[model samples]
Target chain A: MTITKKEVVHVADLARLDLEGEAIDRFAGQIDTVLAYVDVLKGADTQGVSPTSHVISLFNAFREDEVGTHLEREAALANAPDKDDENFVVPRIVG
Target chain B: MKLHQLTLYEAHERLKKKDISSLELTEAVLDRIDALDGEIGAFITVDRASALAAARAADDRIASGSPAMAGLTGIPIAVKDLICTKGVRTTCASKILENFVPPYDAAVIEKMKAQDAVIVGKTNMDEFAMGSSTEYSAFKPVRNPWDLSRIPGGSSGGSAAAVAADMCIAALGSDTGGSIRQPASHCGVVGLKPTYGRVSRYGLVAFASSLDQIGPIAKDVRDCALLMNAIAGHDPRDSTSAPRETPDYTAALKDDLSGLRVGIPREYTEQEGLHSDVSKAVAAAVATIEALGAEAVTVSLPHTRYVVAAYYVIAPSEASSNLARYDGVRYGFRNASGTDLLAMYRNTRSEGFGPEVQRRIIIGAYCLSAGYYEAYYGKASQVRTRIREDFETALEACDVILSPVAPTPAFPIGEKVDDPLTMYLSDIFTLSANLAGIPGMSVPCGFSQEGLPIGLQIMGRHFDEKTLLRVAYGFQNATDFHTSKPKR
Candidate 1:
């Protein structure tokens, strides 16, 4: 149940977060404390209980494929931190 | 009463009678905010020009004497920063979205606009609605109105504090665990978290989708019902929204609880760390309900202890996935130092997000990791099923369950902020209602020995906010707790 500093760094990487030396250790200690506390759930007798991802039972909300009124391109890019006239700008991915 | 201090219903009545203009009321509330918000730190943004313009438009609507004029017409209402407004900066109280303005209004905002409710401003909250105390807000911490040094219970703390301080007539706040009710309890106002699907979540910034719901924070039960009436409805945009019809919540606000069976959960009263003043207040509240002809019964939620544990796993798992959208390319803060895409993503997130948010993301990533998913997230989900069943069985015997909204009243601002587990435990009573997807509300019950407000919690069957409202209305009518305001 104990999360090590190395594991904390790995998890932070998985979450797209950069955790440095002290933050990694601090998060490791904190996460371990929380995990240990939540370990109390291990004693619950949930023998055959089905897991509930959502409380309400909802099916796929299908809609007819048709063009509808939507956000204009200008509005869509209004808040983009880095964007060109037509698209969002980002670091080059494909080498 | 001063125009700023008028309740939503009271203002509506005056507006209907042509006794006062919406412009005057909006001005009064704006003036109050101008005077008090410096001390309260309740609002992140207050748009005076837009609010005044909206009020004038509402005045025009009132002048037209249109038959379609609704109850909320011309009433100024503050929105939580998390809920999107078409052109307003909707920062879920985070640095990442500090400059982000949504292009579209949330479904609730659209509904409120349709009713001609004036938009006053956006209230502060925990960054990404992640913390129990508003101390986690990136902008600033919201102070409790009753005692300035104490924390306003959060992540809806700003909305609750705003309403309590009469900065706005009422407000809309979202609840995942106890965001709405806990703050409402601390601020001595009424708050309701409708059933998971009772209100649409189209633009609520996705905290924990399954557990998150939008509700009201207001001065009393009637105003809560009025706001609920305005916002509670199914929307196609939110696929999880229940297809069922929303009842007129105001019609359900009868002051008689003659047929109501109020259940007192033994585990809640006996739970450790409950403040003695809170216990006494809840006991007196139960007696008051009993005197109003409602029979008090004992009910058991056998999975009570497992709620906080299960919730930490489930909510964070959802949050980690939902928050993946903030990668810096599309809106929000970006770190300019990164030379590559992976570095860009990491640097942007690590810099944009605050410490509490990062802590949660790490916890979520760790729990849902390949090696531990079954033990953490999967086990928690199963325990969630057990928790839901506990409510189902308890509600079968009683019409509504009553308990203390929070174990204690508002604590000092810095008391539990650094201690995440202790802060998490403060929401012990309120999280179960969210896990069970039932409606829960908080009504002012009494005051602590230190003069802090204590609230009584009422929870009812799924999609049955009316019962919770009814019981709360009956209790509020019998007591003056809801009428008592803080002396600032």
Candidate 2:
């Protein structure tokens, strides 16, 4: 199955990416090539086989519900691109 | 031998014997990096001040007769750029995080520091660990020490290159799909990918969460084991960390391979693109194991053909979800040219991420998209189950499996960068181990006709790193391949 340029743009929008003229064409081609290669999975016989999300079977790794030492606000906000003293500043979400 | 060329164990012994100070060892390593890294491009950031301070502290600790001194005490070790180092700029070789300094040390970094291992620098990698070759790194591509024109296998290319060039005593590398072992094979060093949960993944910038594992790249098997001893264990921070007891990896190193059963997977040997030289070298390695009294047995992994197909779908899908957090808000690069929130995110991500990363994200999003999920991601997961079961059944017949690490040695820098499918196929042999959550390692086996190094890959049962280390140690003990260093 070939991926079209329109599909590529749609996927990019869903992925929150901006693809311009050349990049859109390039990504569409590359993604199509990869998809064509990976289409071999459709031939594999996986009847009754359960999908393995995690290789090691561990579940509900719960710790005690106690407050612990966490990253201080200053440190947490240290790498923020734009931040006030209290919170990170993004483009106004609710205009 | 120069102080910089000494293995982690040798350096530790000298420090313990008062024959050398940690300051001197660290200085030698820093000097090596200074002289060679300009050509090799192995380091993204060299923390000279912090490294020296840590070295001096280690020296004082040793002098104080502190009982806590460990193998990595006072040893300068490079870390791959993806693993978070507190206060150090940890860019996963991407523009998105070019200047980002992590707020805290990763779990492995914390463990290494507890052993007093000096943090020499953060090494380069594929941008967000996306590519097989370090060519995808935003800063620069890491050149193989053996051949300057060749690419150092990556996304942990810098870690392996640094170790091979003696820029550091040892280094930490993360393996998602051949990130550690492939580069270690190409650079002619030792690298291991512990079972998925064998090493805590906390603070490692996620690429493919289930498949990503932080392991060691070192000069030899013993040093790899030493680094593993320091880093492998359970942590409350990583939910996937194995709750099992950590064994003394060094204890697993014995010169005897007696009573060992080595599995030779027919599918691997018969796989397309297996280089003639690599096949010969691995054959010779199997013979060496047999001479050491190992019983060779043929094993079959029927699902080997589908590994790359399955891996690409699964890894990128997870990466797409994991990387969605980098949308110009909390940290990393931001392009403020956009007028709205959605536009800001799109502009920031497009401008920040490199081409290969953006491509993977797009592919991943497409795979996990509503209409295509069942055919691509879901089918790939089921194929993954068959691959895992293939290993389980094959491993039941033998103690460990051996194969060629890569189809061939390090290729020239730009050879496969444009051809992503070829690059993905190069990782075919290494991806199965990760897919199955089994421990795998690469040890230098022989040199190709053109003088590039070839590595023999040894894989073992889930959480059975000891046997892999044991087989590697035995082979290294019997052969001089691991001792052949790259000429400057």
In terms of DockQ, the best-performing candidate is 2
Question: Model 2: runs farther than 4 Å from truth?
Answer: none
The DockQ of each candidate is 0.85, 0.89
Where model 1 places Cα greater than 4 Å from the true spot, the runs are none
- lDDT for A29 (candidate 1): 80
lDDT of 2 at B114: 89
Residue B14 error, candidate 2, Å: 0.4
Instruction: Please give the C-alpha DockQ score of model 1.
Output: 0.85
Q: Candidate 1's residue-wise lDDT over B25-98, tens digit each? A: 99999999999999999999999999999999899999997746797999999999999999889999999999
Candidate 2 scores an fnat of: 0.91
